[model samples]
Target chain A: MAMSTASRVRRQLPTSPWLFAAPGLLIIGAFILYPFVSTLVNAFTDRRTLIPGRFVGLANFRELLQDDMFWVGLRNSTLYVVGVVPALVVLPLLLALLVQKNIPGITFFRSAFYTPVVASIVVVGLIWVWLLDERGLVNSLLETIGVGRVGFLSDQWLLLLSAMAVTVWKGLGYYMIIYLAALANVPRELHEAAAVDGAGAIRRFLTVTVPAVRSTMVLVGALSSVAAFKVFSEVYLMAGPSGGPAGEDTTLVMLVQRTGTGLTGRVGYASAISVVVFVVTVALMLLVLRADRRDES
Target chain B: MSVMEKVRPTASRPRTDAREPRVTDENGRRVRVGELVLRYLLLLAVLALTVGPFVWQLSTSLKGPTEDIFSSPPKFLPGDPTLHNYERVADTIPVWDYALNSLKVAAANVATNCVGSALAGYALARLRYRGRRAATLAFVLAMLVPVEGIIIAQFTTMRELGLNNTLIGVVLPGCVSALNVLLMRNAFLNLPYEIEEAAYVDGANVWQRFLRIAVPSVKGTLAVVAIFAFMGAWDDFLWPLIVLSDPSKFTLTIGLNYLHGTFANDERLVAAGTIIAVAPLIALFACLQRYFFRGVGEGAVKG
Candidate 1:
């Protein structure tokens, strides 16, 4: 059957296969692959938005070292990963366990919990912006409770922290679903055995469930860390386009947008920052995966 | 009760009372009433955390201008519910146009991803061709290259092609996403080869077999791709913000940002704008949640 199928599939016109793959290949090559290569090339050149630039080697990288905004951007982006990844990893697992049982109306609760995931980040960002506004629900509630109105969007560290919280909030449902799938695959016997051995819920979770989904937790760590590193829209929307007070809340991607756009936009410099982003994202992924591997060993 | 009977719900006699239906876990073990109550409390708390903000936004949007939105002890519900804010949002910006633009981009994204990925995926999976591995590799590599990193170059590419500020430019870069192509490839690869072999033997061409046989089998995956494409395009902020310079061409996300930026003073207007932007997606998600959850599971496992 294999031999016959292979022969039959080969009988089709040679051009037909290329035709089938043409549109996808063309678009991905043009927009994704080609631009990726150009980002590498353009990183070395002093290209502006309008002016085609000549290769200037590592001047952009050297400039990045001296650029204060670049450092601010790096600091904030790194802080974002630190602030967001752990909460994303642990909280969602708990949420998944909470929703895992097939209680009546459990499906509705699952979907409802996932509502934030479905909404656009812009909407989510804006919603939180208002909610965290000094005159908004959070502050209003706070003031009523005698804590007084705290400015969530004004202070630099607080702004970054708030953005991280929003990132975690929006992401909770997404990672919850991922953990739910992972939890479903955990053997009932392992859990039952643990319970029989006099393990409480927390003990069972640590011994049986944690070990079972440890790899998934690693996967979540890797995925969320990478995403958190590329953090833009949440901070962008919450902090406004200028990226909060004195641009202290600027993320790497935000810096890229701010620098790399407009007629006078420093395309080369932005690409250089982008290169840094790419390198760090790759490193974060490797770091998480290596940690998982080390644990296995 | 015997120990065995206490442990097993089935071994015990069924309850005669119909008023309170027995609640069982996935394993069909009856949960204790205390535990069930505790679970409900946790579920409701999480529900409020997750779904509460959107409700707050909706309520704010509905509140009339006369109502104090910023009153201490923030009003959860509008004292006088009205569509006045929605009207003001439209009056302030060409929000309907922006929404239309978003719809156009999202619809185009869905169509292109569905058609383009299906064809590419079918070819990669079903066709025995040279360089198929390289083509597949190209997509994998493309998928790995994050869009945030490539925006400057993509913007240049769009400018060079004179596509910047156009909806086409906004839609082009992601119209046939490599991830969707790979997803479709996996879907096609999972089908039994014998079915296609029969079609080939019956003289159905590759295209015919793909359309009539292969495509139908993977409608679930296709729907998944479509939903994600629409959501991705609609919810996208940075790419559209970068690609589109003209206010007329701004998608809903960019427009919301504009609205928020210009009208930050009025929470009511901004709230209305967000509601307009998010309501359709929430509705879409509500209607197709089963597929959405299935997609999430499949995508996560595959990832």
Candidate 2:
């Protein structure tokens, strides 16, 4: 047998590299790679439960096209992304601007804000459920101010708004910390120069600070949208797993879970729905990346 | 100490802008003072908004069952504070068992990620290999793939492996975080190549060089990875819920969710369970905040 090109490259490359990457690659292969490929194949079949079913090419996708729940989930997820991303991105930048300054008790404020982020989503949901309950503290405060009780969790529209508020509240400090790190890299002289040129604090922020942190703004935008799109646990805990009344709060992930694990047990159909979820989320990310590049150029 | 140093401004040096008294003294001082006051007020408002809910929950958890948690113009403080709800929570659920399960999953994740990711990252950064670019791109794409999208398949995988309902199954999928791999890779890339080359010249094999040289050099990044892995495993709810059917195998999050579902009427007890679940994570974050904040930027800035 002749020495082959593969053998030549194998000899050239250190085998220790493979030794090093083996454990990581093995686990990722078994878990992520295998599951991803299985999900892809599963989308084409009628597989459900532990029993493997026969292939039904594109049938799941076909049914999904006409599925009303799928469309509702798509709409709700989009609405969630639209409702939450702006505040999650913009408010953090403003908050970072406030806390980035070296002042007394700044760390205390930082920790206080970050406390929510540290808590699990379950805990966050529990606390928010209590806070926004019909006869809860918020309602009591509103009553004291002579306003009627708002059904934050009961009313569908208010439920959606409350979910967004909870997400924004939890995320504000996390993104603020990211922006704080970015703010440190922005040279101080730019602000001083702007000040020397008679620009006020707000003017300095608008002209100098915002522009410097624009990339982080893009980052925050992308991250928050991804998070918003994957809005399951919040809706699950706040609303029920049936995604509240009329399925108004159901995101695509919820739909996938409902189809796969719900009474239906249609794993293939759920896999098909997840394929859509993957496509749409990756598309959203690409759209942001492309827009960011366009802005840069 | 470094966090404190960063937060403290150098006020020891006296002002030297007296020559520009008209510009620096009059308008600047007034405007700065006004801005400072406004900033403090707005920041305090945000602080109250962020921490106020937790405070309310803590109070609610501490209150007696007959205190009327729903009282209008709700009391911020518990008048007759008690640990009755906490006792109820402990009585109701296997809180300690769930906590022990969570700790096992989190510790396993930290160990696996720190060791596996460091090895892979070192190889990718320092060792010559075929398909290195492909490997790196795979990790990046792996990160962008939504976990829920493949969750059904992941469940099937766990079942196939006979690891279902086991803590190992819960920890395996997340053992090597793509983010940490990238973080460690970045940390390794920033290291001076000369040291590794010298070790090689001194007859050190790749493993020896990696262990003695590269691993020691990236302790900070390792700490970051460890914390990230710990928090991720600690905070996970969905995967564990999917994998572990047995309540005995349940993590704290699942236990709390169980409490929420079963004890829907008992708000204070549920609140107590929530606190039990969250308090450790908050304490961990407090201890490792410097590394946590730095880790967030380390990944992002390099990207």
Identify the leading candidate in terms of DockQ.
Answer: 1
Worst 10 residues of 1 chain A by lDDT: A5-14
Model 1 lDDT at residue B25 = 83
Worst 10 residues of 2 chain A by lDDT: A1-10
**Can you write out model 1's per-residue Cα lDDT over B174-273, one digit (the tens) per residue?**
9998889999999999999899888978889877899999999999999999999999999999999999889988898999999999888999999999
TM-score of B-chain for each predicted structure, in order = 0.95, 0.88
Q: What DockQ, on C-alphas, does every prediction get?
A: 0.76, 0.51
Against the true structure, what is each candidate's TM-score?
0.97, 0.92
Where does candidate 1 stray beyond 4 Å? A1-11, B1-9, B13-20
Which digits, one per residue and each the tens of the lDDT, describe model 2 over residues B1-303?
444334433331134343333212211222355666787898899988999888888999999978989988788899999999988888999998999999999999999999999988987788778878888877776766688888888888888789988999999999997778878888999999999878866667778889999999999999999988888898888788788889989999989888888887788998888888888888888888888887777766644
Q: All candidates' lDDT scores? A: 0.92, 0.84
Docking class of 2: medium
Residue-wise C-alpha lDDT for candidate 2, range A132-202, written one tens digit per residue: 88888999999989997988988788888888889898888889989988888898767767877899978
TM-score of 1: 0.97
